[model samples]
Target: MTATGLTPSTQGAPDPASQAAARPTAHHPARAPGRLARSVRRNLTAHGFLIGAVVCFALFSWYPMVREFLLAFQKTERGRTTWVGLDNLTTVVNDPAFWQAWRNTLLFTALALVLGFAVPFVTALVINEFRHGQGYLRLLVYLPVMLPPVASVLLFKYLYDPGYGLLNELLRLLHLPEQQWLQDPDLAMLSVVVAATWMNMGGATLIYLAALQGIPGELYEAAELDGAGLLRKIWHVTIPQTRLILTLMLLMQVIATMQVFVEPFLLTGGAGPEGSTTTVVHLIYQYAFSFNNYGAAAALGLLLLVLLAGFSAAYVRLSRTEEA
Candidate 1:
């Protein structure tokens, strides 16, 4: 009925779909603000947590390191602080105990690697072979790690007592001559290493156990099919599979053993018979608290820090190269 040859009502009226599409959407402005507020609150909360962590690290860790670096160059005497440059380093180097401490520390590190490093891996391997009671075994192995460190050290001290100690009693019962465990200078460092290994190997054992569990069974089976013995399988399959973890553990063990303190400090009173157990950290303790030479302590600590940092850097670089 119109110029287009359609009904007038159809021609004049708007399409329902077009009107629906063209009309402005009914947005809930309240919802938009609510969402924005929630997002801002979340961001603020996350940032607050991040800021708290950063502040804590800055206050506790970074500030102390910076202070130590500054203290290494400055000396406090008679309530007056003066910059003494390399005097602290010279003093620490000149101390008679310095070389002795370094020697003892290196010896302890070697001993610990032989005992502490190998014992845990062997224990883990043994435990991993068990088909049952794995959880109980793990708990038993980790029990020592759960004990308070001071309590454990005291316990070892009691056990090391030459007179009527359990270890001495066992030796006597077995018709073996009872040796002075901690009294003799030759035995003192070895006794301390033993105690240290017993105290710390629990954690390492669990870590190795976890690494061993992650190795696929197929490799072991293939190794068995190749007529490999237990030792051979361990060497070829197990070691390769856990090579990364072993490398990491080796580095950690070296670092930890080099910083040996608590065991020697508790077992032999920081300086064992004839200064045999005098470690680098023990020397630092002597310098700071015993000798009241904070500058010397800081200088010694800086040397240790640099040595450890350099070793860690080298280790990381080597690991990266191996991975590549």
Candidate 2:
């Protein structure tokens, strides 16, 4: 022991300043390489899994879109390709069918919104309110969607025939006027929309049904307590609750009906009487297949793509804003 009566090693506490100086910092330079290496390895593995999808999109989707764009600005003749600037676009824009196709497309979209959007929603509501036989009703509603497109279109064509069709026969039996369905230029587009709604509405109905099942029953109870009638309850509680799905479905219907082709092609020979049902997509098909003018087809298709893309972008922006 030292003469001061303390062990030699216990004579003084360690220096706090020296201990603090010896401690490691949170972001030590020596540990950075290991962390960076691990991050790079993880990213490489993730990208490896995405490689197949990237290749497929590049080969199929992106390449075709780019080719279509290029074809819109170029012409092929005598096994040669040459840039034609805006010639194809100018030709397409000048065609009278161009405006008619746009008008028909817009009309079809409007009709589809009314039928495709509302019918499914209302059907869903009815189906949801059912205390029994829900499964059977759902099956009946969805039966049409299971049919092949060609089969459904042909079936509707038979029904819309002016003479000897079941629909006309039913009208005769019911004492309703035997009006021309597909044969009438005025009603041709409407008939096509009806057939389309019948065939495609099952999907939307099922989607709406799913959404309806998620709604809280308390909302309805509160609406009832507030003396709301059926329609008022729907307007105040149901629509607001399902507004997102409704808007999304509305946009989807617009896009689908705008590009409608198969029903019109099969039912009305692509243009009906006086070119009534000639849609933009049908016109593109005519340009490409019937007239053998791929340049014009691509140009028209590019325009349609641009317009639809704008709508989609607007929807995306609105959805984002709502989320924010």
**Against the true structure, what is each candidate's TM-score?**
0.91, 0.84
Candidate 1 lDDT by residue in tens digits, 164-195? 78899999999999988989999999999999
- List the pairs of residues colliding in candidate 2: none
In candidate 1, position 192 carries an lDDT of 96
lDDT per residue for candidate 2 within 1-324, as digits (tens), equals 567776455547778897899887687456688899999999999998799889999999999999999999999988899999999999999999999999999999999898888899999999999989999999999999999988998898789888988899999999999979998889999999999999999999999999998999999999999999999989999899998998888888888888999889988899999999999999999999999889999999999999999999999999899989
lDDT of 1 at 75: 99
The parts of candidate 1 lying over 4 Å away from their true place are 1-30
TM-score of 2: 0.84
